[model samples]
Target: MPSEQVLLKPRLAPMIWLTETSAPVCVEISDGLRRTLFRRMSSLISGSLVGLIIIAILLYRNPIPAFFAWAAVDTILVLFRFAVIGRLMRILRDPSLRRPRDTLVVDAFIAGSVLWCAQIGVGAFLCMSLGDPVLAVFGTMLSTGIVGAMCARNPGSPRMVKLQMVLIIVPYAAGAAMGPEPWLWPIVLIAPLYLWGTISINRELHIDYLKMLMAQQESSHLALHCSLTGLPNRSSFKARLKAAERNASVLFLDLDGFKAVNDQHGHPAGDALLTAVGERIRGCVPDPADVARLGGDEFAILVHADDERTIPAIATRLIAEVARPYALPTGLVVRVGLSIGIATRRDADNDPMLLLPEADQALYEAKRAGKGTYRWFQPANDADLSSQVRELRDMLPKAQTVREHGFEAGLSVTRA
Candidate 1:
C-alpha cells in the first residue's frame, strides 16, 4: 500500500486526501487510500461469511419466511460487491489505464464501499425490528464490529468516512427506537454518541499521517534537487536521461570564467550567479528538455525529440542566455561564458547510454576550440560511435560500479 518509495514517481501531489485535481504528469492514487480499500475488501468477505453462518443457525432454530427473504437479498448484494472489489483491484494496477481511468476506478471503489455499509445498515434495521431478542443482540454485535473495523481500516478522506459512519448507524438507531421493547430505546441515544467518538479518533490519526507524509516528500525533493539553483541534481539528470526517447539529444554545458566571479566577488556572489544562470538556461528551453545542475559550474540538458527546438538551436540559445551579465545580490555585475557539447541519437536502435560519453567528448572538443562556443560530435559515421564510446570508457574505467545507483558512477571527466 506504500506508494512506490522511488524518487521518480512523477508529480508530488500537493495534498492527496480530501481533494483531487487533474494530474500534471500522470494519474496516481495515494498509498493510504489503496491500503484502506484492501482492508475493506478483506474484512467485508470474512464478515459476510460469518453472517451467513449466523443466519443459517437462526433458520434451523425456528423457520421464518421473512428472515429467509431478507437473507437472500442481502447475500446477493454481498456477492455483487465482491465482484466490484475484484475488478477495481485489477484496474488499480494497470499502468496503461492510469491516466484515462484513475478517477473512475477510485470513484467506483468509494461507491462500492459506501453501498457495502448501507447494506449493513439495512440488515441492522430488519433484525432490530424482527421483535426477537436473540436476533436483535446478534445484529447489534455485527453492526458494532463493522463500525470498529471501519474505524481501524479507513485512512482515506475524513469526509468520506463521516458519510459512511452516518449510513451505518442512523438506520439501525431508528429501527431500535421503533421496536416494541422499552429496553431498545437506550440504543438510539447510544448510537449517535458512538459515531461521534469514532469520528474524533479518526481525525487525530489522519492529521498525524498527513504530517508524516509531507515530511517524507520534502526530504525526497531535497535529495534529488540542487539546493543552490533549485534544479535537478546530477543523479536526477542521469535518471531522466536513462528514460529518454530514442531520438533524444544530450547537451553538456560548462561555465567559463566562473572562477573569476568567485575570486573577485566572494562565494555568495558566485552562488547568486549560479542561480541566475540556472534560471536563464531553464527559460531558453521549453517542455521535454529539462535542465540539471551537475555539480559546480557544470550543467546538462536532455532534449527529447518531442521538444520544438533542434539540438543546435537549443544549444545556441543556452550559450547566448548564460553569457549575459548577471547582477548579483552583492550589487556586482559579473558575466560567465558557456561551452556546450552536443550528442544526438542517430538511430532508433542506438543505446541511450552512448549519448553521455559522446556529449562529454564533444564538450572537450568545444573547450579545446575555445571557451564560449558549442561543438557537435564529429564521428566518421554512425558505426564509429561504439568504438569512441569504448575508448571513452577505457579512459575512465569501472563497469559494475558505474551502472549502480542509476549511472551516477559512470562518468569521469578530468578538466584540462
Candidate 2:
C-alpha cells in the first residue's frame, strides 16, 4: 500500500489552567504579571488542598463543631476564590475583553453577576447550617453591593477607584463583624487577598489603555505618509500647499517613457525606477520645498525658490538626475527620463487647478520635443493640438484596412 501524507495542524495554547479549577489567564498582558498571577493562583490552590487535608486529619482526631464550621467557611471562600479568580482570568484572556470599554460594559457585568450569585448562595448555606442568620445575611448583602458597585464604576474613573477601595474594605468589615470562633480567621485573610487581586486588575486596565493610545497614534502617522516612498501623500500635500502663503511655483513632473520601462523590463523594474525617481526629486527639492507622488509615474513639487531663475536650474537638475542609468533587477541597465512642466504663482492664474492644466499643456510640449526636458508655460504659445486627433492617429494604423472600406480623411494627422 502507498503511504499517504497527513498534515498535522498546530494547536493553540490552552486558555484555561486545570490545576486552579480551570482559571483563565490573559496572555497579552505583561509576561511577569501574567507569570505572577499564574504562580499565585496556582500556589493558593495547592496550599488550599494541603490545608484542607490537615483540617480533615484534625477533624478526625477531635470532632469539634466549631472547627467544622470554620473549615466550612474556609472551604467556601477557597472555592469562591477559585471560581472568581478563574472567571477573572478567563474574562481577561478573552480576546474581546482586552479593551477597557469591552471589559467595563461586558466582562465586568458578567463577573459581578457571578460573584453576587455565589455570595447570596454561600450566605444562605451558612445561615441554614450555623444558626447565625444575621451575620451571614448581612455579609452576603455587603458583598453583593460591593461587587455591583464595582461593575457600575468599572470604567476607570475616580468613582471606579473609590468603588474598588470600598470593595477592599467590605471583606475586612465582614470578617470583623462575624461571630467569634473559627470563621473569623479565614475572613480576615481572604479580605487582603481579594484587595491584591483588585489592584492587579486596575494596573492591567491602565496599561491596556496606554497601548491602545500608542497604536492609534501610529496608525494616524502612517495615514499621513505614503507607504511606497515614505513621502507625504496627496492629502497631506494639498494641506501643506494651501498653508504656504509665500510666492511659490508648482512643477508637475511626469516620467517620460515610463510605460516602455514597464513593458520591456516588467513592473518590478518600473517600481524600482519610480522609487529612484522619487529619491532624485527629494534631493532636488530643498528644505521647506515639498514633493509628493501625485499618482503613478507622476509627481508634484512645490518650491520656495531663492529666485525665479532657480526654476530652470531645478528642472535641469531633475532632468539630469532622472536621465542617469538605473541598474534593473534583471541585470539590465536602462536610462530613465523625465518631462517636467513649471508654472509660477506670478503667472496670472490664481486657481491651483488652472496651474495643473497649463503645466500639463507645457508637459505635452516637452514630451513632443523628445524625452528628458522641461517646459515652462507661456501665454504667447498658441499651439493647442487637439487630444482627439492625437488619439485617432494612434488608432489609425490598426484600422487602416477598415478605413479603406468607407472612411474619408477630414483631418491632418501628426505624430506626437
Candidate 3:
C-alpha cells in the first residue's frame, strides 16, 4: 500500500460511515468482513460436522448414490473453504504479501461461500424428492438451523449472507413445489418473506458494527495528533522517525523570543502564533506528516534528502518563512524569529533515539552563533563554536538576509 493511502483510509472511514454514500466499499471494509467470518468459522464447521453425521445415519438403509455424491462434494467444499480462509489470514499477517492488492484472494472467499451454499440447497432438494417423510423432516430441520446460524454469524458482510440465503432457499422451494407432500408446499410460498426479513435484520446489524468501528478510528486519530496544531504529537513522531531509520535527517527547531510574545500579549496570542507556524512549516515540507509539534514553541521535522546541501537549504527557508509576521484573530500582529539545527543520519547512525539529541545539540549551536542563524551538527565545533562563528561573521557583510547567512531582518508588532 502507498504511505499516503495508509494515512488516508482510516481518516476517510468516518466520512464514509456518516454519509451512507453509495460508493463501493473499499478493501479495508472487505478485510474486516473476512475477519468477522473467520471468528465464527469454528462454530459453523462444528455444526456442519454434526449435521453430516446425523444425515449419514438417517440414510444408512436407502443408499442413494446421488445423495452420497452430494455429501462428498459438501465435505470437500467445507475443506476448501477452510483452506481459502487460512490463506487469506496468512496474507494479512505477512507484510511481504500486502502489495499489488490481489483480487484472487478475496474472490476465493466469495467462490467458497457460493459453492457451500449451493450444496446445502441441492441436499435439501434431493431429500424432498426421495419421498421419505422422515429424511425430509431431518433435512428441513438441519437446513433451517444452518441458515439461521449463517444469518447471525455473517452480518459483517450482509450481501454474502443474503446470497447464501437465496442459494439455499431457492432450490429447497423448487423441491417443495414438485414433491408429493401437500403439507410441505407452504414453504414455497413462505420463502420470499423469510429471505426479505433476514436480509433486513442483517443490514441493521451491519450498520451498527460500522458505527462502532468509525468511533474507534476517530478516537485513535485524536490520540496520535496534536490537539492545538493538528500536527503529529511527540509519540507519533518518534514512531515514524524510527520507521525511517536509514537516510533520515532531523531538523530541530525553536521559536526565538516566543516567551516575550506570551509575556507581552498573553497565552492565547502564543497559541495562535504556534498554529500559524505549524501551517507554514507544513506548507514548505515535501510531506506534511513529516512535521511535528513536540511541545510549546518547539517543533521537529523528518526529511528525506538526496544530498547534504538539501537539509541546510530547508533549514534556511524555514528560518525566513517562520520569521514572517503572523496575523492573529485579534487586531494585533506578532513577529517571531526561528532557530534551526540540521542533523543528518550517517551510516553509523543505526539507532533512531540518537537523532533528536544530535539535532538538539545543533540547535544550541545555532542559538549561540546568533539567535536567527542555522548550524549543522558537527562534534568537532562543540568546544570552540563561538570562535568559529566569530571567524565566519568577520568574513561576511555586517547585515545579511536569512537566505544569505541565516540572519533574518528584524520585525515590529503592528495592528492588522
Question: For each candidate, what is the lDDT?
Answer: 0.74, 0.58, 0.74
lDDT of 1 by residue, 1-416 (tens): 32331111213242233332122222323453334445546777887777677667666654778667767866776776677666656655644433443444444555666777787787778778766788788778878777876775665466667777888789888879888877898998999999998888767666665556557766877999999999999888889888778768889999999999889888998899999999999999878687899999999888876543577788888899888888888888888999999888877788877787898899999999988889998776767888898888886655555556345433333321
- Cα TM-score per model: 0.79, 0.45, 0.76
Of 1 and 3, the candidate ahead on lDDT is 3
Residue 268, model 1, lDDT: 92
lDDT tens digits, residue span 96-115, model 2:
44334322322232334334
Model 2 poorest ten-residue lDDT run: 1-10
> Which parts of model 2 are misplaced by more than 4 Å?
1-226, 347-349, 379-416
Q: Rank the candidates by lDDT, best first.
A: 3, 1, 2
Off by more than 4 A, model 3: 1-34, 54-62, 89-103, 129-131, 260-269, 329-332, 380-416
- lDDT for 257 in candidate 2 is 80
Predicted structure 2: lDDT:
0.58
lDDT of 3 by residue, 1-416 (tens): 43322322222333223223232555554445444555665776687686677568656946788778887888788887777767666655663565454435445556677778888888888777666787778767766767777777765666667778888877877877778888878888887777777778777877777666657666776888999999988898898888875678899999999999989999888888899999999987875339999999999999877576777678888889999988899777889999988778887457866788889999999999898978888865665888898888986665444345442222222321
Among these predictions, the greatest lDDT belongs to 3
